[model samples]
Target: MQTSTIKLLRALVCMMLMNSLNAVADKVVTDSPVTDLSQFAYPVQDAKEAFKREQYAFVGIQLHDTLETPGVTAREVEVWSTQPVEPLNTRWQSFANIEEDRTALLRLRQYANRYNLMTLKLLKEKRRSDTMRYRY
Candidate 1:
């Protein structure tokens, strides 16, 4: 009976440790597009041109640009926590005049937010897959 009880307690402790590890493994640290972009090297004009060429570039640029504005006192971290609607809308309008690169530009612009979202999602998923790979 004593041996059985000890085994049961050991099992319980193991189970608890496993659960804790799993919880930590499942955890993900996500920041706003603003902070994420700040870590990367962004060339505003090149990004804008990439928007015209790949259109997808716009997504990255838009987030970075929105975060980089001079007097927008809001935290980039906070701004990225939510879907950046106003910036997307504004970017959409900004490219409306340039007809030649309009399609790719718009497509890229439209995808910018999604790209950032996916990047965060991938990072989260990667954290789950490889706990050591992601520092956060």
Candidate 2:
């Protein structure tokens, strides 16, 4: 009778742990914002043109799409700030002073510029490699 009670108690403890784990998983899924990239209008090619035109909002949207692409993380975006450090005195203060919308737009712009530059560098390297291959 005591052995049966011990088995039942172990089963109950296992059930409770399973339930707690499921609850935590559900919270994580619900907390993350679902972004539909298909709905966004601007493409990467248009991003540079949009920036040149000073259409910051469109540029921001393009950047957001780029940042959301696979292998990119929130930490990468967080590290890429638009503002220089010397002006703010502290990093947190720089981020804090801006309105949420403005801050988001700035972040997007910074990301877009970085993305464009990286793309250009890759293309140049690819071209150089192709030239070297053809010459040999």
Largest TM-score belongs to which candidate?
2
User: After superposition, which runs of candidate 1 have C-alpha atoms over 4 Å from their true positions?
Assistant: 1-59, 62-105, 132-136
* Clashes by residue pair, model 1: 55-108, 56-108, 59-112
Please write out the lDDT profile of model 2 over residues 27-119, one tens digit for every residue: 643432322222223446554564455333311232222323222234433343232111111223233322333434444445545544543
TM-score of 1: 0.25
lDDT, each prediction: 0.42, 0.42
Task: Name the lDDT of candidate 1.
Answer: 0.42
Query: For residues 102-129, could you state the per-residue lDDT of candidate 1 as single tens digits?
Result: 4433444445444444434443454477
Candidate 2 Cα deviation (angstroms), residue 56: 19
Model 1 residue 25 CA deviation (Å) reads 51
Q: For model 2, where is the 10-residue window of minimal lDDT? A: 82-91
Question: For each candidate, what TM-score against the reference?
Answer: 0.25, 0.30
